[model samples]
Target: MMNLILHGYWRSSCSWRVRIVLNFKGLSAEYVPVHLVRGGGEQYYAEQRRINPMAQVPTLVVDGRSISQSVAIMEFLEETFPEPAMLPRDPYQRAKVRQLVEIVNSGIQPLQNLSVLKRLNSEGWDSDRVQSWAADWIRKGLLAYQDEMDSVGAQYSAGDSITLADAALVPQLVNARRFNVEFEGLSRLVEVETRLMNHPAFASTRPELQPDMEK
Candidate 1:
């Protein structure tokens, strides 16, 4: 049996993405909490930096080999497990799935992540200003995501089946709600999120249910 260990924080959207993938694949990994805020961010410590050079959460250590970044970890798991696939088989469909995934992974999540927010704070941005900044970026990316959904199927981000796009979208929605980002024109995303959240993999692995979740 391959021993899998996941080092992450409860509320980190990237970490939450990996959690959803793990649950969807029915894989179990020992969870290790890395508090992103406590004591000036534990991820900066030498131990975690060694494990993940980027010092990011959702670092998947598989049989002693560590892989950082949520998308990378998700792909690794999908390629290794193969069963209960999270990506489509057709070339075009697979590319579409990756496009949607990147819409969230690359376009949306980074601007509002903890480190970026912390940097804004250091640069003298007040709480309200920082929140507004984050919300604006989220809105922009979500609008683009909504536009792309015209090509996707109705039920989920990509299609009727849950794909990597759904895994990426759900966690970003969580962050959107956190920043109070308006969803007026993004009804499709909201509807898709409603359906996705009902799935056991998404519902069970929510940040609130994680063992390291804070009250």
Candidate 2:
């Protein structure tokens, strides 16, 4: 049996990133769904919070130790299972891949996360205002993402070979589409996302296909 246990919600973009990386590495884990909306979030429960103090999804348990954060989990997997590597060997290329990953992870995803939007709602922001808030950040981040891609993008976000950046891009685009973010000038990034959507490894882990995804 696999020693890995992954706790996450199906619709969570961060969780989606870890799922993609696990598939890319040809690894399997016992998936434990932590419903983000049910009962005001299962992550906040004491049991789940013990595993991840942040009360966030996508916490990974490997060899009896808990690892939080999707990017960190992916990095651990990359280091432990290096075959069919997702990152390039060259130092410069590796840094470039991380740069792209951070653009989505820190820049785009954070600004559009459910918690942040809900906080806006709690602060008396209407749905349209919340959407505008997300759209503005997503648009600027994606435009910046496109510019970075133009310099080094290939079949994937980084190059012909898939990398950490691709793992981050697909899910960010999903959020973008959900918010109706415009893509008028992001053809390259869109093409990369399109290819990933068709890729078996990435496709299988989509939110709709997850075990916990509501029908």
Candidate 3:
């Protein structure tokens, strides 16, 4: 058995975070697809539910011990493996990297998550309206990120190398573009996301490459 089992949807941003970390660290694990759109999404399926009561995708099971939250999973992998480090070596710098990532993980992503969209749907919001909500939050959140980019520069989110922030940035950009949230101001992010798209680890993990993707 692969030591880790990733219960996630290919299109999920949170799931993508963990995927990037796994690839960056050269960790191979079982990919367990959970269709987040079918049958109201397999994340809600009873079996997956037992492992993750929150019914969220990107749940990482290590040695059959479950973990939730993308950042938590990222940190866990970093600690467990401790090779080809994903976080910066400097403690304060690493915290800064994490702070930038935090804005995305907690501040920005939740506003646009599937469950939030589903709730808006129950309130009679259409797809267009829901996407508008996503775009609104993403635009503002990324402007804040633009400031980070201005301070941090190109090679990294907080420093001159890939760190926690870069891992978080790529998938969020994908989501932003999907919702028509422009990346105009955050030029550095666009540059980085493009680079990451071609990167060996990032390229292989694109949502479109997943086994169950719809044509």
**Of the candidates shown, which would achieve the greatest lDDT relative to the real structure?**
1
Candidate 1 residue lDDT tens string, 1-215: 88999999999999989998999999999999999989999999999999988878979999999999888999999999988999989989999988988989989888998889989999999999999999999999999988887345579887788998889999899899999999899888989999999999999999999898899
> Cα-based RMSD of the predictions, in order?
1.1, 1.4, 1.7
Q: Please list the C-alpha lDDT of all candidates, in the order they appear.
A: 0.91, 0.89, 0.84
Task: Compute the lDDT for candidate 3.
Answer: 0.84
Q: How many backbone clashes does candidate 3 have?
A: 0
| Sliding window of 10 residues with minimal summed lDDT for model 1 | 145-154
Q: Write the per-residue lDDT of candidate 3 for residues 1-215, one digit (tens) a residue.
A: 34998888888989988988999889877989898888988888998899888888889999989998899999998898878887778787778888889889987999999899999999999999999988999989888876866255566566566776888988998899889987677777787777777777788888898776677
How well does each candidate superpose onto the true structure, as a TM-score? 0.97, 0.96, 0.94
TM-score between candidate 3 and the true structure: 0.94
Scored against the true structure, residue 58 in model 3 reaches a CA lDDT of 84
With candidate 3 superimposed using the best TM-score fit, by how many Å does residue 67's alpha carbon deviate from the native? Answer: 1.0
lDDT of 1 at 114: 85
Candidate 2 on 3-114: residue-level lDDT in tens?
9999999999999999999998899999999999889989899988898998898899998899998899989989999987988999988998999889998999889988
Greater lDDT among 1 and 3 belongs to 1
